[model samples]
Target: MRSLSLSNLLRHHKHTAFGHDDSHLPRQVIEVAIDDSEDTHELPARKRRGRAQSTAGTIKGVIRRASLSLKGMVHVHRRPSVTAEPSDLNQQLPNGRPTSAHHTWNRLRHAAPFRRSRSVYGLNGTEDGLYEQQQLDHQMPIPAMGDEPPYIPMNTGAAAKASVALQNEYYNRQAMHTQWLQSASEDSNDRESGIGIVVTEPFMESGVSDDGSMLGQDSNISRIDFIKELPSELAIHVLAYLDAAALAKASVVSRHWNEVVRNQHIWRESCLREMTTTYATSEPVQPGAGLGIPEIAPSKNWRQIYRAKAELAQKWKEGKACPMYLNGHTDSIYCLQFDEYKIVSGSRDKTIRIWDMQTLECRLVIGPPEVVNAPNVLEDAEGNPTHYVNLSDSYKAAPSKPQVASFAEHHKASILCLQYDDEIMVTGSSDSTCIVYDVRNGYRPIRRLTHHTAAVLDLAFDDKHIVTCSKDISICVWDRATGALLRQLRGHTGPVNAVQMRGNTIVSCSGDFRVKLWNIDTGRNIREFVGHTKGLACSQFSEDGRYVASAGNDKVIRIWDANTGECVREMRAHDNLVRSLHIDSVSGRLISGSYDTDIKVWDMETGRQLLYFPRWHASWVLSAKSDYRRIVSTGQDPKILIMDFGADVENIEMLKSANTGIGGIRL
Candidate 1:
């Protein structure tokens, strides 16, 4: 009965294990009694029924265990486990409980079945054991209701194949990344090497790159643009290193760069800067005038009459070509002439000044008298001195403070031209009259030839004739000996402005835009050159008499063949009117002066502009003449400028001193 009761109790507990409620009290008591009794054996009939039922339950549990084991085996076959050392899987229990041999043996037993199944299915035994051990470890904590199933291992074919494939993919990716890195490193190394070679080469010989070029090369290396991009102040400092000739060339590079290099203050600073160095060692100790003949006169000693001229020349060189300052004239200078002993200047100040040519000092200023005398019988209202008159009261006179030359007051208007022959001087006035003065005698006019209805613009004289052109469209040939009118050649329809003589032929230019060639003997117009588009200013025949150069307001300087009267060459010579033209007979060079204040030298044969003096004058260069090695230019600045083009420096220095004034020296 106890055995039967034991079997009944076990069966009841089995059903109750899965139920939520417990209703069998007898079954519980029977279970307690069987547990307390020793040797509690069952009877045949009850034992048989109990054994059948227990067998059925055990079989059902075994089938369930097999199914779970099969599932674990399949799972393990798909994915292999990684083996870890005992140290790697270490786990601390609560209260730091130490692992015992008994615990290890039990754990091994729990994983034994999985290990066996793994071996049969061609799976890794060690990996299967690890996986199964982990499963048993989790299940061990739960109380066993009937029987707990053991872990089973799986096959390893799928997991091993998957791992090999993954390893191959990883190796391929790594190889590709390494190749990319290597290529990039090579490219960087190549670039660095190229740059090093380029930087080490000399600028002139190197073919690597140029900053000035506009091609694919880097702009930082371009020579010209790099220079241009420099800061203006820095650029000015660089330009300061250049000499005058170099600076002048730099000014033509570009407009912005030109402004930086051509600044007047910069030029002045450079002049002063250079002077500081030169003055310390090379200051002129002796007067330059005493070194040679005075520039004004080849035959005179400038030292006696003009010691100041030597001092001024030294000062001019030290000052580095600064313009000379003159203070006598109140208006623009219109005419300048140098004689053997004096430098005469005429101005709109209504005065003519004679400066000591040797001394470069103003010696005399002659104008109309302060007072003039009326003719007898000319009376005032008071009639006090009707028969007598004060001659000084009839004209203007110069101041008495400075010693001045005696001059006749005759012209009622500005004097345009002056011609001197020894003691006789002839002056053409804007008043349409020519006055002949006996300069050796008292201030007296020998004759007044009134032939033109308009101003006499120019006058020329030879040994026999005095030829004059007037605004009245007439050319008057006169006897220079007696101031008598010889003949009048009248063909121009406009103002006849300039006259030139070539042997017996008198060539005249006019506002009629024509050049007329006339026979002085017959007073007949022989031929006319009629290609000028503007009024002619001046004309001159070449020294060989083969060509005639004519300049005018048209800004064109035309050279015409003398016999054919056909234009041989035309030069756009000036920005404004060509005021004067002079040819160097010995050098075959042509020098032109213009209202643009510029003087240009040209090679007549090639028609090429040789040199340009852009700012030689502050106003119109009204006249220019060159005598082989020296050029003299006069402008509205009331000063004559002398330029020497000779090999003898001593002679030039002497000439500079002799021709002294508030003007320029040629040397």
Candidate 2:
């Protein structure tokens, strides 16, 4: 009987295999036989007419068990056949069929739950309501395992309300999930697009924690403080973009930034950069054969090369004022004079220094004598006081000394003024005397005029006339040939400080604040140009004799039309008082020296300052004079400076030769 049952099972399994290949048939058949044996005794019996029900039930049970076993085996073995070569599974579906893998997955997901609850809910008949009911079901709590519950249809009453609520919640959850996915996609898109927008989103989201309060509060504070603490260098970088006026104001905001902007090099570089950019496109540089080609044939002397370089440098600095450095004095220079041959400077150092005009080098320095009476003290054989007699006789018999004496130690006071004619030089001093010296000889004093009660401040000369002004408010006119006082002009209420002679008109400036024009022959004031507001320090007539320029303690230099007495032009000449004035006849250039230690030249025609020679003295620039080609300035620095407006080439060459190779001497 068992054999029959097994054979029957084999037959049923074979029939269920359908079109499966027989290569795996033995394994399937063995599995089915084992399954049938395990359940053989427990199977229900089959019933037959008039047979005992127990036996019949047993038979039926055995048949049913065998049948189920055969079915399970067939299902396992009935896989579609695979050929040795891969199958061409690229077959087309029927027209109008959903074709993609994605479509298939979606359709399967929707159909799974619908198929499960179709009968219990009658969902198959109501297609539209089926989706709504499914949505409701998703919201309900899940049932425990193995509990098969009936589908509950959504309705229009309380169940409808519950259903609507459930539908809303389900949709809301779906929308939230969808939104989250969309945001994540957008964030990824932003990152990939390099927009930089979404990069900070994580930080923004994290800024507020789960409790909705800011995280890392102290860190945020610190970050804010850090931003506020940006360095001044950064501030300056920002300010650099501002306009010049605005930038200038910003420099005052802080000391550090002020220092940066004040640097001249920065401004210079900025100017260069701006100029380069501004002209770069419009201006094309002319091509050069080489850096510098000699227009003249090259010479063997390197001096030629140096000379060319210096010439180029001078041309570059043309129209610009240059500094003149002078050194060759031992005491304050009291007088300065220059001619074609040499520059002569007299100093209280009791020396007269002579500088070669062409070479601009000191040629000689004449110092004071050790003794003034050595020649006269010589003995005549007997050793008696040979020339000694009465005081008047001794004075007359004494050998004459050098008139142009350097009474450096002998004089108790400073020399105030110096004047020279062809053969004689007369020096006025604070010692109340005018000493006349024969300059052609060894500086022997020809005579001494001692009538002045106070220091002699100024001296002037004509062919046979000698005029001197003194602090005694007096002017003494002396006969130059006889060394005798010719006349005295004494109307000035204060010290007569300066004297000038133009033909017969003797012009004098005084501390009395007036320029008194006098007729030298009559020794009487013809007219007084009296508009000056301060003590007159200097006065000079124009070369044309039409105007007189006077300057004083008021710091203004006024030019008066000498004939009309009309103020022509008033120049605010210096920061300090004007100490001296000299007009160059050839150039019509007015030179003024000031207590500010500056020598300024002005064009008389335009009344414009032409050149400013600054710091010409460490103290007051006491005097300045110009002869068109050169300017000579004397100051309290005890030095005389000779400035050449011509032949700077030679000067530059000399300077270069002195500075270079070998002995390291500078001319």
Candidate 1 lDDT, tens digit per residue, 317-363? 33222222233454566666554345556665555655543344454
Q: List candidate 1 stretches off by more than 4 Å.
A: 1-327, 339-341, 371-402, 405-409, 439-444, 644-648, 653-667
Candidate 2 runs further than 4 Å off: 1-326, 360-412, 649-667
What TM value does model 2 have?
0.44
Kindly list the per-residue Cα lDDT of model 2 for residues 1-667, writing each as its tens digit: 4444545534533443233233564554455454544333334344232333443567444444444444333222111223412232222334333333334333323331211221111211121111111212343321211112322343446444443443343334344333222233331232212222121332322232222233322333533322125675564454445544444543543345556555443333332222222111123211121112222222223233334434643543343433344454546887666655455666666455555554555544444454223332223345533222122212322221112234432334556677664477677777788777665654456788879999888888878788899999999999988899989998999999999887788889999899988989999888888778889889887755677899989899988877877888888999988988997643467899999998888867667887777875789987788752457788888656656554444433222211111111122
Error of 1 at 442 (Å): 8.0
